[model samples]
Target: MPKLTSQQQYNIEQVAATMAIEDMPLTERAYKHLVQQATGEKTADQIAEEIKKEYQNG
Candidate 1:
C-alpha cells in the first residue's frame, strides 16, 4: 500500500468519524466494499452502470 499524505489521512479520519456518527453500518460496509472493488479495477462509469443494474434488478 502507498503512504497517505497527512491531509489525506485527516480527510479519511474526518469521513470515518462522520460515518460513525451517522450510524450507517450497512452504508459504510457497502462503501468500503465498493471502494475495494473500484481501486484501479473499474472505471467510474462502469461502476455506476453496475450499481444501476443492481438497483433496477433488486
Candidate 2:
C-alpha cells in the first residue's frame, strides 16, 4: 500500500475521533480495508460485490 501523507493521516484520525463510540472501530476497520482494496489488491467490482453481500446478509 502507498504511504499516506501526514495530512491524510491527520484527517483520518480526526474523522475516526468524531465517529460515534459504537461505530468507531468498525468504521476505522472498514476504511482501512477499503483503502487496501482500492489501492490495487482488490478490484472495484469485487469490493462492490462484497459490500452488496454484506448488505444482503444484514
Candidate 3:
C-alpha cells in the first residue's frame, strides 16, 4: 500500500472512531474501500458505478 498523507490518515481515523462509537462491524474490504474514498483514490460516482455493476453482475 502507498503511504497516506496526514489528512488521509486523519480522515480514516475519524471514520474508525465514529464506527467504534456506533459499534459498527467493519470488514477489511470495507475499511480498504473507505480508505480509497477518503484518500480521493475513488470518487463517489466511481464507487456507485462499481456497486451498480456488481449488483447487476450478481
TM-score against truth, every candidate: 0.45, 0.45, 0.73
**Models sorted by TM-score, best on top:** 3, 2, 1
TM-score, prediction 2: 0.45
lDDT of 1 at 57: 100
lDDT of 2 by residue, 1-58 (tens): 5676676667666655667455655465567755655455667687788889999999
Give the runs in model 2 whose Cα sits over 4 Å from its true position: 20-23, 33-49
How far does residue 27 in candidate 3 sit from its true spot (Å)? 1.7
Report backbone clashes per prediction.
0, 0, 0
Overall lDDT per candidate, in order of appearance = 0.60, 0.65, 0.81
Residue 51 of model 2 has an lDDT of: 81
**Preferred candidate (lDDT higher): 1 or 3:** 3
1-58 in candidate 1: lDDT tens per residue?
Answer: 3355676556656666777889854465455544544354556677778779999999
Error of 2 at 31 (Å): 3.2
Sorted by lDDT (best first), the order is: 3, 2, 1
Clashes by residue pair, model 2? none
Off by over 4 Å in 1: 25-58
